[model samples]
Target: MAIDLAPISLPATADAEQFKDFGREILGVNPGGMSEEQMKEVHDLLHKYSVLLFRDVDVTPEQQYNLTKSFDPSSENHGHGNDFSKTPGRKLFELNAIPGVPQVKLIGNGTVYNHEGLSEAVLKHPSHTTFHKTHVSAEDTAKGITRFQRWHMDAALYDLNPPRVTTLYAKVVPQGPHQTVRYDDGTGDELEVPLAATAFVSGKTMFDILSSENKSVAVRGRVKYSPHPYAWMATAHALSTGLGIVSEGLEMPDDELPLWDEDKIKVYPMTWKNPVTGELHFQVHPCGVRELFVDPLPAVASREGALYPDGAHLTNLMYKMQRPAIAPSLVYPLDWRENDLILFHNRGLLHSVVGELKKDQIRAFHQCNLAASDEPAGPTPEDVRKYA
Candidate 1:
């Protein structure tokens, strides 16, 4: 049997270093009107790249949702029954949508044209408010927490099974250099950085660069994460202590956020196999990990050494493991353009939005996420016996 894929042209600006023969920037095809054959080509290409950039394309919220389904049938996934709107009736999350479209959320920032009615309500959303131009207080930095300036996988905080694909479309973007974005190292060391770009780190490269020992740690080991509440309040409550949840989301009267029980914290294998490509990808969500534990837990202490203490050793190990993943060679900072649509494999990449928006900036992006395909992340009993 032969597979006849649709004819899709990859733009010359698709570039070399970032693509590495995997990613493709399709500026030629009209994804909104792509046939099933072309859609399959896009799907297969996405597995190879783990990231796909579609620039200057005009796709509506509904059209975007339909296009995503062309790749992953599960993109239209419904109700996992965990609350806080998983699928939102199987629709795209329109940050600017008002009056409530059935599946889309109106996360607008209240500055857009004709958005006066929703400005007040949308401004109340945490992502719009509480953003900072620089690190908060010296005390906050010393404690090892700032806003969501670090890299993270989407939905790793709340979803027991996080999404496989995360899509974002730029409806409105803040233009020009901002007056305030800065970097502070907590020791009075600061550097100025431009605002308004999103950066992506390749987990595949992260996995490939590991040493044999760290590679074992990358694949076989386990990493824990803060509970849902702390993960929820990360923007306001990202703590160095790795404990406690203190943010407005918890105190607010709205039911938009979920109140998580500590007993249900997130934990996953350090690496996982992408079901589509069968390629092993480094799986630890860098920002949210509680600690990088050696293979299994203290329950199996009989086989371990006394000198290998927990605490800061594991924390330091987590940082060492993630450092190479953030290097300039592996990280690509996207220059956002108007109507740019990006499809990223949430399982294989770590992404962070750079810069802070002033009160008047119109920088809202539409997000459409596919539901999870695999089990709750981690090593299987087979993995434990083979690697642990």
Candidate 2:
């Protein structure tokens, strides 16, 4: 079967370095209404590239919901549960549903009046200052310096399964000068990003760069996420770079969290296997992780210099492993334009909002992701044997 469309490597941009090769863009395709053949090609391209960009698209909220559902037919509601009003962690997300199509939510900064049935809504853009323990001062921000708001995969981390993909349609984009992202962690790292861009890093690249010993540990490790993770971390402060939390025990006490069932808690592998490529990816949402479990190496394998035979904790270990992957040289910040639709493999990458938006700089976008019907696939026994 020959697919009609061809995807090109991500174009050169201020934040994108030519050396990194993870994202692709398909030109001249209507994502809202794709034929079965086109959807297959797009799906395969997405798995292979991890992120797919569609420029100059015209899609409605209902169309966007249908397109997102096409990727996961069994999925029916929003990724965090459809009823935004009753969801426990709804406060964590600054979202407003698109009137009739509850699956698609309105996101972005500033006020949007009478939009898709929303009458006069005030939006607050996510910022590191509110979440990070330390951040760039107003003086630095005035000088066009900022920090990443958060580094995470879009998921509820509870009863519902993680979404397979997330669709974001930019309806209105604010125009402004580019800002420099400062990693205030004493490393002096910086990235020149477009104002209010979405930055992404590839999980496959993160796994491929790890040492052999770490790879073995990753394959054997499982992460237990806190129930209602967003609400649990609501009061916690993140690290300066937003890669992980400051482990000063700021997490909400288990008894104080919303009513939760033990059976509904999620425990996922540290390394998830890509369904189409069969490649292992080191995927973990550091902020939501509550506990780490690891199995001992195979009897035949050497345990010379291994990690965590008993168990592990979130004591800078996650930051040490994940920090390198988000280095400025490796990140790709997607510069948004009106009518630009991006379909990203939610399982294959970690992303973050890069800069802040002024109150007057209005930006409107429709975002949609449906809870997956199944959990992520983990490393196989053969994989454990090979690495262990």
Which candidate ranks first by lDDT, i.e. highest?
2
Q: In angstroms, give how far residue 357 of model 1 lies from its true place.
A: 2.4
| Tens digits of per-residue lDDT for model 1, 45-159 | 7777777778788876677667755545654442122233442212212233323322233343435544323444333213212333233565543333233354567654444
State the lDDT of candidate 2 residue by residue for 1-388, as single tens digits: 5444444333243234432457777876788888899899989888878888888889999999999999899899898888877776556668888989999999988889999899977887899988999878889889999999999998998999989999999999999999999998889888889899999888988888788888888888888999989989888999989998897888899899999999999999989998899888889998998887778877777777877654455434567778988888778888899999999999988999889778999989899999999999999999888887
Best-matching candidate per TM-score: 2
lDDT of 2 at 239: 91
Show pairs that collide, candidate 2.
none
TM-score of each: 0.68, 0.95
Model 1, residue 38: C-alpha shift (Å): 1.3
Give the worst 10-residue stretch by lDDT in candidate 1. Answer: 238-247
Off by over 4 Å in 2: 1-21, 309-316
How high is the CA lDDT of each candidate model?
A: 0.53, 0.85
Question: In candidate 1, residue 282 scores what lDDT?
Answer: 79
